[model samples]
Target: MNGYDSALFENRTVVVTGAGRGIGAAVVVAFLGCGAKVVAHAGRDLSHTEGDLLSRVPQGARSRLTLLTEDLSQPEGGADLARQILDRTDRVDVLVNNAGTMGGRIAAGTETREDYDHILDLNIRSVVALTGALLPALKAVDGASIVNTVSISGRSGGSAGSALYSGAKAFVSAWTKTLAKELAPDGIRVNAVSPGTIMTDFHRRYSSKEKLDATAAAIPLKRLGTADDCAPAYLFLAANALSGYMTGQILEVNGGQLMP
Candidate 1:
């Protein structure tokens, strides 16, 4: 099959976290277009933007879509989310742990223990815990893929404001590599996508529009990335025919901000 098949995920069931907005929403739409049954989970109630996107799916595809709401940072929440999906379907062909937060208050001596815990809980811990809970369903499929949304900060240290957030994503990147090897025997591939300055509401927590524009200008591509730009990497990883032999890899889609 082609790497970007229009029907790439046909007859597959994929679960995506944080699907109410940004990259998560984009991933859900992409998979749906590829004919996958998507379980879209968001931390809060769906917004008008998300609702509109969902409405665009074809009628026949509507039944293939399921909406879920839950805070995945909690200890029990991860497993609970998995159970909810398993309750509906016997198998999950893909698991995209794309839910994350930008803890932008971690300057020198500014971040407290609570701040550290919250960031880690949302970024690193939730990904690992949720994946562990859903492993069985994923393995039931002949070949499944797990995609984690990491950040450019994870590769290199972040600015003072993003210290803790960067650290948490770094842990995710490292853990993804390890899990890829451990799960290879089960025919499950694990990978991460590290994006830079995406044009999404995700940055509102960290800076104003003016500041964001200035940062975007600093990148070699002279612009910020977008959710659309980053979604294809996840699609690529999730397509078994395209990336069946790939695992433990980090795909950077940062508009040339951090080239390795």
Candidate 2:
């Protein structure tokens, strides 16, 4: 179990949103390593992501990779992505909704409506829309599954300044549970992975080094989780042989930071 499973997803089709960088990028590499036909979806250019992924993805797996760019923040972006995927293939075996944004600290009266819109759109709306758009396709495939990327902030209702972000993720976590029940009969398993403080670009720009160090110290593991650490959880959740009976669950990858 320590070593990677090369043939776990021999011919599976996986769609990983926000695969441009950070955790999203790591998950894509994990899937590709397992012999999946993966579509890496990102809203921005793939200059750095392309390099980051290429270096990690084996030469033999290169042909199985597909880079997709679509802004999942917009209302129609989900439909557009579905169309794009369908045009290329008939079904998607795994859907990873990893595209998300770290919003500015919420100020009660000072925050603009656009701020809330942006945060909710990226963090929550796209997940709902994209999952809905892909529902039938997911059902068509055998052992299909959906893994959503959530946050620790969502569980605690956020820290001092991240109220809006906390709220959006909270909704995502709850929605994940509800979706699991609804899709269970369709043979689609839905689950969420909530990461603690991961050292990704999302934190590099917003989290101070001192703050990260402080948070790391608070964790029982005494370190922040890496994107690589969080990647395998998605595979575990998606692979029916591994988690066939698991659904509507939150697999926390927080280094024992939050026991719940």
Candidate 3:
């Protein structure tokens, strides 16, 4: 939706985490296309960007984009990323807390302490740390927006081996609302986009084709979602011009799955 409104985000600064691929990449592209200066945290390395994000970016947009590789799953990962962004700019118009993963399907009974710690650290702690660290920058601008990437699993409980991941997402969902209340007076809107069964590397790594196909069949639309499908909701929530009165809400892009 680069053409959605080329000037919607003109002169704005957007920061997106886990933007090297999938939904994050699409969001980055959308913001860049709308003329926003973007700081993209491209996961732990640049390898993922080669034939994906890097190729899709317009040549002109490159001049306005900054890519950083950081392992947000680590203890200090979020703080590190915030420091990098702060070094470059003092204001952030939009902050997309989209860096997270299920890691892998570690069965509930078989999960170890390390597994639990890592999952919580990656999905929960990192977001809190990053957002807290960047509060100053976020508040520096008028009507700043924070769009988090939650999951439908957070509501449905997800499939096997995703208990922790689902719970973590639920935590973020609640946190979003709380932050919204706390930040509203500061003119910062906090919201989220919860994607369901998106056709991205996230599923490629964690789900089998048989399972994904079965899910698609169950959806009212009878199709799996794509990264592009979920990206626009984020833009809508982030752009004050599009959703100025919207905050502390979760937009589900699941093609009619779990209407509640």
Candidate 4:
């Protein structure tokens, strides 16, 4: 919705990883509203998140959403996801690399090598592996797009124990630009969206209410962003009509939290 071209993705098959909740759910619903068949991925068994997502989808568009399950943290996860996509459709119009997690904030003294590997594997390695595996399917479709979900923490160093997550996203942001240039010749445009202070389970789980309110107060917009506010940015990047000429770009969806 968001008043953009609702049918911009008509008949297209868009694959969105991490669609079980938050930004991923918002993006899936947006694509469905716009008339695209969406392949939504979740890390675990279908749960309340999927149920909640279904309720938000229009009845007629309900059938457009197909669920795919895979733990992107595992070494074989990306290939597993891509195999399912290829099984469903030969051509993939869009691929949203949104499957990532901000791990438990480990204090400096308590951190271990496993912590670093977990975040890097989920946030950066999975993206690279999935995209590489699906390259053939993406090539089958003209004007295909790869939209990555990066965080504002990636642009500026993260606060407190968020260094690993921030560093991983920074890799993704940099890789997005590199992929955009490398894939441009094949008509595949790669881009990223940097979201800030979005009110979602991400915050509910990791940030206390007082901390969130403090973040809201510091934002120039005087409020935290909602999933709806950031969803349109992903839609714009995925639809050719909106951002065909734009590539290797990172669109910040923050409410003036950071200038970059």
Deviation in Å, model 4, residue 83 alpha carbon = 1.1
Instruction: Write the number of the candidate with greater TM-score, choosing between 1 and 4.
Output: 4
> If the candidates were sorted by their TM-score against the true structure, best first, what order would they fall in?
3, 4, 2, 1
Model 1 Cα lDDT, one tens digit per residue, 83-187 = 787787787999999988875566678778778777778887778778998888888888999999988988878666887788888999999999999999998
For model 1, how many clashes?
0
**Between prediction 1 and prediction 2, which has the larger TM-score?**
2
Local accuracy by lDDT, each model: 0.83, 0.86, 0.92, 0.87
Any idea what lDDT model 1 has? 0.83
**Clashes per candidate (backbone, < 3 Å):** 0, 0, 0, 1
TM-score of predicted structure 1: 0.93
Q: Write the per-residue lDDT of candidate 3 for residues 85-204, one digit (tens) a residue.
A: 999888799999998999899787998988888889889998999999999988988989999999999999999999999999999999999999999999999999999999999999
* Error at 130, model 3, angstroms: 0.5
Measured with C-alpha atoms, the lDDT of residue 76 in candidate 4 is 76
**Pairs clashing within candidate 2:** none
Model 2 lDDT, full chain set: 0.86
Pick the TM-score winner.
3
Stretch of 10 with least lDDT, candidate 2: 42-51
* Candidate with more favorable, higher TM-score: 2 or 3: 3
Q: What is the TM-score of each candidate against the true structure?
A: 0.93, 0.96, 0.98, 0.96
Residue 79 of model 2, lDDT score: 76
Please list the residue runs of candidate 1 whose C-alpha ends up more than 4 Å from where it truly belongs after superposition: 1-4, 48-52
